[model samples]
Target chain A: MMRVLVVLAVVFATLPGVIVVLASLTAGQSLAFPPQGLSLRWYEVIFADPDFRDALLTSLTLATITSLLAVSLSALAAISIVRYRSRATALIEAMLLSPLAVPHIVIGIGILQLYGYFGLRADLLTLTLGHLIITIPFALRMLITSLAGMDRQIEHAAASLGATPRAILFQVILPQMKMGLLGAAISVFILSFDDVALTVFLVQPGYTTVPIMLFGMAENQVLPSIHAASVILLLASWLGVILIDRLIGFDRFLFRDGPSG
Target chain B: MQVAPAIRSSRLSRRATSLLLLAPTTLLYLTVYLGGLVMVLVMSIDVPPGVDSGGATLAHYRDVFGSAPIGAIVLRTLRDSLATVAGCLLLGVPVARYITASASRWKGIVLMAVLSPLMVSAIGRIFGWIALFGPGSVIADGLTALFGGKPTGLLYTEAAIIIGLTNLLLPFMVLSVASSRAHFEEDMSKAALSLGATPLSVLLQVELPLIFPGILSGALIVFSLSTTNFVTAALLGGSGRDLVGYEIYLDILVYFQQGRGAALAMLLLVVVVALMALAIQTGVQRHEVRDTAARTRGT
Candidate 1:
């Protein structure tokens, strides 16, 4: 019963993805299933279009920067929370994680309200900050879990052996956290990359991210390129999952290594 | 006396270092996150400029809650979210059991595959469902062929939204349940079986109660996420139906009625917060009960 159910679960989980891949090969204009013919025309069309090209670039750059900044910031915060053992740590963690429970649409509106209040125009920077608010919690949680489990005795030994503080940080601490750091960074990158509810509002008329652009296209017109673009994104994301799995050995039972569903 | 001074100095330095480590991220939380949320709450009551001719007013809230069409939209959104939660629970429990019971190296890979939906763009996944739910799709055609009737397209329906959201959340449900299941001792279940209890009875009476917290947590997560998710409904459920998130989005962006948008956003915030608080309180209570139970059992 368990094996059959597991197989069913796998089939159900991968069904939509498999359909998307198959549909991407349609030779026809519409996304008709059981493709009349097979071709890569959509992929070519997407490559030819500058909007998708620019949006992809914007998404990659934003995700890269956001992941780097949010992960490191959260790591520092996690260190303090785990190491300091203060009353304020509870309040700080709750505050940091509050954004997670808030609806993305609400967060988007809130950020928009913030922009209006400050008279600041929405741009990649503002959008980055918004994404940071959401992604930092995930990174911080992962780091905290790793930090809590770490062997501080090793660090103490290194210190007693006359190792410099910076050396202990680099050689002792960071190495132990390599998996958590990598997993958190991957999760952050993916979350930021695929973000939409907030990005839809923060994205300006001229500049856009892939998800925002995709949303716009899906709303208004049929871009044959959507198939190609979606396929590419789906593959890229799977690659990220694989990379994370290899790096962190995937906390399988909990599946906490990835972003929350 | 010599050691006392050194200990005091080291304590002071450690405190300073902790503060230093915490300062930057704390600053970010204060300015960006909390400040932004406060602004939204304020805007919810006080009208945004140029949206409508008004100062602080309850008119926006009235429009959201009092109006007939908007009420239906809210009801539909709630229905969709609840349905998604139920669907995920159905799939997640068995999958979670399978994962925790087996000593397979492939468990991690399977778990990742289940969560693979998160990696893809939300918009893209909705787009993917377009092919499956459309009239010309294989499943629709098969239905038509079997029924000797018109093809039943699944797109532009509430069901599509449910399906998409369930797909989006099934991983979370599985992860939650599986993690909780890991804490179950093999011997406990074995003992139950040895006591002449049927496997089914053992599962229902013994295992289900233990993992109920994980199930509830997963359900809360799905409920909160799906309620505010406009993507699936907007893309797959079509424009005929209006979800709260989509309505808020339109009110702000398309109509430029920021006041109304902010009001709806606040209402959504209230629902989300209430659910979150319930989850947190449940968590605290669960921990306390578990600790007490363990202590009594040990004694």
Candidate 2:
């Protein structure tokens, strides 16, 4: 009975993704199951469209920048919080991680209101700011874990060996945290790339991210090209997952710390 | 005593260095995230015509609470979220048990395959549902042939939203349960079996009680996620069936009523956080009790 339930649940959980991939391969004009013929015409179509291309470019650029910024910021914060052990460390960490507790939609609204209040325009900078709030927590948590798990003896030994702080950071600390930094970067990229709820509010007219564009398509008219775009995103995200598996082991990263994004 | 001054200076320098390291990100969060949330709270109660011109008012809250349509939407959100939680529990427990209990070589691969859907964007996954639940779709056709009636579709219905949400969040449930199951004692089950307890009885009487905290936490996550989910509900529930999040979207984006939107958002946030705090409180207390019981048993 348990076996049957697991099978059913797996199917229920995975059927949508499988269907989406299949539907993206439809040779016919519209999306349908059991495609009239199988082809990559939809992928070609979406790729050829300038708007989709622009959105894709924007999402990639945004994800790259956001992830880099978030990881770098978090790497610094992790160092301080783990090494300093100040009374305010817990509160500061919680403040950084509070985005996970708030809904993305609320974050969007809050940021939108903040922009309006501050007279900030809804541009890539502001959008990156919003993504930072969402992505920072994930990066921070991963880095903190890696930092906490590291052997303090090694750092002490480096210090006693007449190593400078910069030398310790560059030669000792970063080399050990290469996997954590890489994993955090990949995870944050995926989160930023897939983010829609917050990105929707941040985008001004004619400036849509890939997920937001797909969201608009889903609401108005879901072309097979939308499915194609989705397939592209899925593949990109899977590529990230594979990289993490190679680097840090997927199960250890995922189950050990809960959901990535 | 000779090194005391040097140690104090090093401590001061360490404090300064740590502060320097943490300053930029801390400042950014303070300005944007903390500042933005405070703005939302202020906007929710601020009277119209201007933020600076008016005293704080509860008109938006009153509007949200007193409106019948908004009430109905809230009720629907709660009902669907609860149903999604129930569905996840039913499917998630068995899958989690399978993951934890199986010693197969393919365990990691199977787990990855089961969870890979979480990597896909929500819009992508929902588009697949749009295909499956549409008229003349595979599900509709299968049901028609099986039941011998007109084709039935679940598109744009409450059931569709429930299914979509359950699928979207099942990974979290599985992760939670499997993590908890990692620490489960195999000896207790073996001991129960040796005492002539049926497998089903052992599962129900011993295992479920032990893992109840996992289930509770999973339910809380699923419930909170589904309730605040804008994408699935927006896509599956369609127009006029907006969840609270979607309703807030319409109010702020479409209708341009920031006050009402802020009010609704705050209400949703407060309720979800309150439930989480309450559940986590009980969950932690229960975990402590369980640990104490296990210690006593060990002694």
Name the best candidate (by lDDT). Answer: 2
Off by over 4 Å in 2: A257-261, B50-53, B143-152, B279-290, B293-297
Candidate 1's C-alpha runs over 4 A off are A1-4, A252-261, B1-9, B48-55, B104-109, B146-152, B284-299
What is the per-residue lDDT of model 2 for residues A1-261, given as tens digits with 9 covering 90 to 100?
988888888678778878989988999866656556899999899989999988888899999999999999999999999999888777788788877778888888888889988888867799899999999999999899999999989999999999999899989998998989999999999999999889888897678788888888876775788889888888888798888888888877776543221
lDDT of 1 by residue, A1-261 (tens): 767767777887888778888888888887757776989989999888898899899899999999999989998888888988787777788888888788878878877778877887766788789899889988998898889988899989999999987798779988888888888888899898988888887888778888888788876767457767877777777777778767665553134433222
Best by TM-score: 2
TM-score of chain A of each: 0.92, 0.94
Clashes of 2: 0
Write model 2 residue lDDT over B1-299, tens digit each, in one string: 97999999999999898889889999999998878888889999888985555588999999998999999999999999999999988998988888787777656766776776666566778888987886667877787788877675777889999999998998878876776666577778898999999999999998887777878888898899889998888888889888988999989999989899999999888988876776566568556756865795789
Docking class of 2: medium
- Estimate candidate 1's alpha-carbon lDDT, on a 0 to 1 scale: 0.80
